[model samples]
Target: MSGPIRLWVAVKHGVDVVLARADRSTGTVAMDRAPRKTSDFDRNAVEEAVRIREKLGGTVTALTVGPPTSKEALRDALALGADEAVLITDPARPDLDGRGVARALAAYARTHPGFDLWFFGEGSTDHFTGTIGPRVAAEIGAPSLSYARRVSVEDGAVLVEREYEHELEKVRAAFPAIITVGQEINQPRVPTFMSTLKASKKEIRSFGPSELGVQPSDWAPLARRDRVFVPEVNRKRQAVSGADPATTARGLVDALRREGVLP
Candidate 1:
């Protein structure tokens, strides 16, 4: 609290929902072929971390756990204004589930401590479980402030405003806290050409399971994904043909009523 704030933000390189396509034959998604990008909510978290650093005079370090390709997300974070980036990866296990991810992050903290604040998105874009932030907080024995719409530091403590469906809650906690932010907190800044170039030049420190003291059991996934597919939606191809507009409207109303879409 007395020294410069050490802000750490976690990001994910997840599948791009908009670009991912389902297989026509199997009806399952082709995850291997799908394009990947930084998670949307994580971008907001990075922006907020950068803003806080700019205001409070601190450093923002972006960290990620994924395959080697996850370095792309770190580069994006650096371009967005993070001071540095760290990537935790395992070539043997490219895909890590939520539990494994949390364990790896916790191990990082144990090896490299002295973090004042940690930020995470409410959830990843691909799998919106909203569990990573809380899990990490619990693992590190830090206070978790989830679903933060606004955050600030005052009197050596962190203040958070949590937004709910019909109500809002204000929470305060000491330093070394974890905050998961939503998109409503702030709009993420777009990286300019120069920033992108600079980010590309910055070296992203890489760590593997061995380096982080992660054992085989620790890296083992807690849950398995059976399959991913888009649900099929059938449409009624009924024709409401009529000579007059009034008749057509009446027919449409009748159809809606029969379908229980109208009361």
Candidate 2:
């Protein structure tokens, strides 16, 4: 293999299997909860990058921006066959939105040049904001394509296909472009026991805003959260007492009609 490509795969660690809360007072979504694995779409992105690297003979570097506890996602990436992992942790950036996170990642990418491609998921499962990859690419002045369902490289160029509401689109772009993979892009591979153990021992590079040459003043608020609150669970059950089956049936129909379940 010749002309080995350097691939950077972005992953995210979000709240564990719990419903996201929107702060009603501050409009900020609260993320201070137990950390979980990488986003499902992001796992596909990492797996796609790893597969590309395996075919093209290159290095796959997994990068994530989150709290210190986000290292778990990096370890999982390593277990999935990434060559290296980088975790960007900044206490001041605890509530970073897509734009802020993109700025940081763009700066990191600028510092480490010679990467042939940048890969990310279409969106994070928790936030569901499909903006980071495009934002990072714009900040770095690189061309980008999002929602890619299939991708292949040929003659130093990338061929990709994506779906629109009513159309299927195909794109061919040069190297050093950013691409966001959708769930349909590829199925993520499960890690073996040995791979898991090896990933646990892998060295993860950590950085902060200062290390990335980003000042607090340089950061701009792209999105704002007003408050965070758990949604109230409604589990009221109604019981109807009836003496006959016909009466019970009539009651049930009445209840369904009242709830607009039937006309």
Say which candidate scores most in TM-score: 1
lDDT of 2 by residue, 206-232 (tens): 888888888865556667765455656
- For each candidate in turn, the TM-score is 0.91, 0.83
Report every candidate's CA lDDT.
Answer: 0.93, 0.84
By lDDT, the best candidate is: 1
Clashing pairs in 1: none
lDDT score for candidate 1 against the true structure: 0.93
Candidate 1 structure quality by residue, lDDT tens digits, 2-85? 789999999999999999999899899978668999999999999999999899888999999989899999999999999999
Q: How accurate is candidate 2 locally (lDDT)?
A: 0.84
Residue 231 lDDT in model 1?
Answer: 94
